[model samples]
Target: MPISEEHIGRTYPATAPYEVGRAKISEFAAALGDADNPAYSGTDPVAPPTFAVVLASAAWGAMFDDPELGLSLSRTVHVDQRFAWTRPLRAGDEVTATLTIEKVRARGTTAIIGIAVALSTTDGEALCTASSTLMHTSEEDAA
Candidate 1:
């Protein structure tokens, strides 16, 4: 079944607190081709802007596995992504992400799902808001 507008506004549970480590930040930065940047090489480094996606991506599993949405993992394609930050993530910050379904639109056998993820400090300070759109094509040949 295709997702509908009614699925919008559905919020999922918060993910477990994930501690940001300096090493991981360095690794991510280097992977993004910033290996020589001083900002990401120190013990108290600030994460690259896109690092929030690391947390958001993990929390997204819940939405895909939800039976009500009936998503076909194999058929989904990430169409777009955007991020809004109150502050850059720093190493040693403990954060959690909560995902919400902002919108669901369908055309023929294809569905576009808009997901909003809120990343916050464990004590409730806002960190970042990440929004993503995924397009899922209906499976017509799978057994």
Candidate 2:
């Protein structure tokens, strides 16, 4: 089934707060081949710019798992992703993410979905806004 136009402005539930820890920051930076950066690995660690994706991806998952959305992760291709941050994430910051579907367009057997994810501190301070475009190919042609 194709993504429905009626779902364009839908917003999903906010994710549980995720606490940023020094070990997790170090692991993420290392996975990005940035372990040598003092800012990400030092005693007082500041997460790199792209670290917000960790939280945003979780928000995206909620949308993907929504039975009403009719989305199939196996048939989707993430086309683009961008992030805007108010400040660098640092170890000890507890944050939660909420996702909103901004737009949806269909072409032939493919649907383009726009998603916006907002990350905020547990206390409600805005942290980052992450946006993505995904191309979900209809399962009928998955072969």
Candidate 3:
């Protein structure tokens, strides 16, 4: 079955609080092979504006793996991404991100799903918001 507009408005709770730590920041930066990025390095650590990808990667699975939405994980492609930052993430902050399905649109061979994910501290202080557009291609489009 193809993705339907009915999947819109689905919202999922925070997967888990990802603690921002100096070591984790270094590891993330190192994984990307960008150790020279000042914000994500050093003892007094701070992270890049888009460091929220760490949280997003973990939280995104809920939607794709949702059987009700009938979204095929294999056929989906990340079409676009934008990050809006309220502050730079620093060590010792525990952050939680909730993924919300904001919109779903479909035409002949493609479905565009938009999500607004909120990344905030346990006390509700927002660190950043990531908005993504996922394009799930139909079998025809894939072929």
lDDT of 1 by residue, 1-143 (tens): 45778899999899999999998898999899997888887666899999999999988988988888888778889999999999999998999999999988887778899999999999999999999999887765333
**Candidates' C-alpha lDDT:** 0.89, 0.89, 0.83
Please, what are the lDDT tens digits per residue for candidate 3 over residues 77-122? 8889999988888988899989998888898888888998889998
lDDT, model 3: 0.83
TM-score of each: 0.94, 0.93, 0.86
Question: In TM-score terms, which candidate is top?
Answer: 1
Candidate 2 positional error at 66, Å: 1.5
For model 2, residues 1-143, the per-residue Cα lDDT tens digits are 44778888888989999999999899999999999899987677998888898999999888888887678889889899999889889899999999999999977778899999999999999999999999998876787
Better of 1 and 3 by TM-score: 1
**Which residue pairs collide in model 1, if any?**
none
**Model 3 worst lDDT run, 10 consecutive residues:** 41-50
Cα lDDT for residue 99, candidate 1: 96
The C-alpha stretches of model 1 lying farther than 4 A from their native spots are: 141-143
Error of 1 at 91 (Å): 0.6
Instruction: Candidate 2: give the clashing pairs.
Output: none
